[model samples]
Target: FYKHMLGRKVIPADLEAFDPEYFSNLKWMLDHDITNIVELYFSAESDELGQQKVVDLKPNGRALPVTNDNKHEYIQLMSEHKMTNSVRQQIDAFLKGLHEIVPPELLSLFDDKELE
Candidate 1:
């Protein structure tokens, strides 16, 4: 479900989806300062030629640098931001259309993955 926290695939069980180099890159990022993730902001290519349009994930929190202790929270927020917050309008629109085609109450009976 959308309300459920997304899985952090950094664990060993999820390693089947990754190559060795992927883990190496992740380890590299973990060892470095969180400044390396400054590009984590939500962005899309703009209609104006080659420009990018950056959309803030939240009103707060982006200003602070992520530390080792708070990295788990950062990852959770990032997942939430990427999966839902950033595309909220689109998701709403999609849900509205889906509900129009199929009843939302019935749809809600199944989890998102099962619905998919």
Candidate 2:
């Protein structure tokens, strides 16, 4: 999915590269579906700087619709597991910033509760 969505082959070196495309794909995953898999991938790649890169690379405009049919299950699973303080803080800050620009009708799509 990463390769297909990103329009590039992800080589082993890509993981360490932390290139713009790599972070862009991660943002794609997060915006398309809020899933544990996305969270795990983000967490594994996350550093203070990396998190900022992901946020900066995220798409602007209306939110993408959730396509995963099992999205509710994923949300439940995420809520069941406790997030580290750092991750929580990152998410909180991201959502707060997002809410400021996202359209009012689209705000529900990014409800922080569903992401938590």
CA-lDDT, candidates in order = 0.48, 0.37
Which ranges of candidate 2 are over 4 A from the true structure?
Answer: 1-79, 82-86, 109-116
For 9-94, candidate 1 gives per-residue lDDT tens digits of: 23421322334554455455566776546444322222233555554444554455556656555554554554455456676777
lDDT of 2: 0.37
- In candidate 2, what are the lDDT values of residues 1-116, reduced to their tens digit? 12212223334233323345654553454457554443231112235745533221123311332335644333333222223222556555665666578643554444333433
For candidate 1, the C-alpha RMSD (Å) to the true structure equals 6.8
Q: Give per-model TM-scores.
A: 0.52, 0.23
Top lDDT: which candidate number? 1
Residue 101's lDDT within candidate 2 is: 82
The Cα error of candidate 2 at residue 4, in Å, is: 24
